[model samples]
Target: MKTLTEHDIRSSFVNCSKGEAKRLPLPKQLADIDHWDALDFLGWFDLSAPDRSYLVAERGDEVIGVTLRSPSAKRGFLRRSMCSLCLTSHPGSGVSLMSARKAGRAGREGNSVGLYICADLDCSLYVRGKKQPAPGGRMEESLTVEQQIERTRGHLDAFLERLFV
Candidate 1:
C-alpha cells in the first residue's frame, strides 16, 4: 500500500456525497503512519459524527473508498462475534456492526450491507501481531500468518467492491 494523503482519501470516496466526504476525518496519525506495510487499508471514524466512518484501500494502482455507518454497539448481546471482513473474533470490545450504503441511486433508495467489523478498524495490525487480540478472540486457523493476511485483505476488498457494484 502506498501512503495516501487527505486528498487521496477525499477523492476516493465512491459511496457518499462530496459534502459528506469533505467532512470526513482522516486518521489522527495518518501523516505519521510510516508503517504502511503493517496496514492492509486505512479506516477511521469521524469524531464529530460518531455514526460516520470511512475506509480506503489500494487495489492495483487505484484507491477506493467507501463511506460506512456505525450502528450503536449491541454490547453484551453477541458475546462471541467475529468480524466478517477479517474473521477476527471479539469476545469483548472487538467488533461493531458497520454498514455501508450502496453506491449511487441505490444508496439513496436505502440499500445497504451490514457486517460485524473490527470496532477500531485495526484488523490489519491485529492480524500482523502488532496489536493484541481480545481474550477468547483467537480463531483456530491452519493458514499461515501471511495466508491469513491475504485472506483478510481479499475479504475486505471484495466487501468494499459491493458498495459500488
Candidate 2:
C-alpha cells in the first residue's frame, strides 16, 4: 500500500457527490495512509446519526476504495437486518443493518466490525455499468473501463473479508 494525503484521497473518489465527499472527516492518519492500498473511501450523512467516519484503502493507489461507516444507534442500513455486504439472492429482500464489529486485535476489547452492504450486488459500480455503454457499442471486446471495474469489485470483496473475518 502506498501512502496518501487527505487531498489525494478526497480527489480520488468518483462515486459519491463532491459536496458530500468533501464534508467527510479525514482519517486521523491521513498523512500516513497507504493510498495505493486503499480501494476507496466511504462516507455518508449524519443528519439522523452520529459522527461520520471515513475508511480508505488503496492498492498501490490504483484500486477501488473500501470504506465502512462507524457504529450508530439510529440503524440506517443496519436496521434492514441483513448483511449489507452480502449479495446472495434470497426469496425475499434481505436488508440488514451494518454493525461495527471490532476489527484486528483491538476488536476483542469492544472494537468495531462489520457494515451494511447491499444484500444484492454492490450498488456502486452496478449503477455505473448500467449507465455507460461499451465503447463503439462493442460488447465483445474488453475495455479498460470494464477491467477497472472488475478489479475494483475484487478489491472490495477482499477488503470486506479482511475487515469482517
By TM-score, the best candidate is: 1
Model 1, span 1-165: residue lDDT tens = 788888999999888889988977788988888888878989888888877888898877899898888766557845777888778788755688889988889888999987779888988987887887877676777989899899988988788778766
Worst 10 residues of 1 by lDDT: 71-80
Model 1 TM-score on a 0 to 1 scale: 0.91
Q: What does candidate 2 score on TM? A: 0.34
lDDT of 2: 0.42
Candidate RMSDs in Å, in order, are 1.7, 15.3
Cα error of candidate 1 at position 118, Å: 0.8
Q: What lDDT does each candidate get?
A: 0.83, 0.42
TM-score versus the correct structure, for each prediction: 0.91, 0.34
- Candidate 1 regions exceeding 4 Å error are none
lDDT of 2 by residue, 59-159 (tens): 44353333245434343422224223222222223332344433445544555545544332233433234332223212332446546455545645564
* Candidate of highest lDDT: 1
Once fitted onto the true fold, the runs of candidate 2 whose alpha carbons sit more than 4 angstroms away are 32-51, 59-63, 66-71, 74-155, 158-165
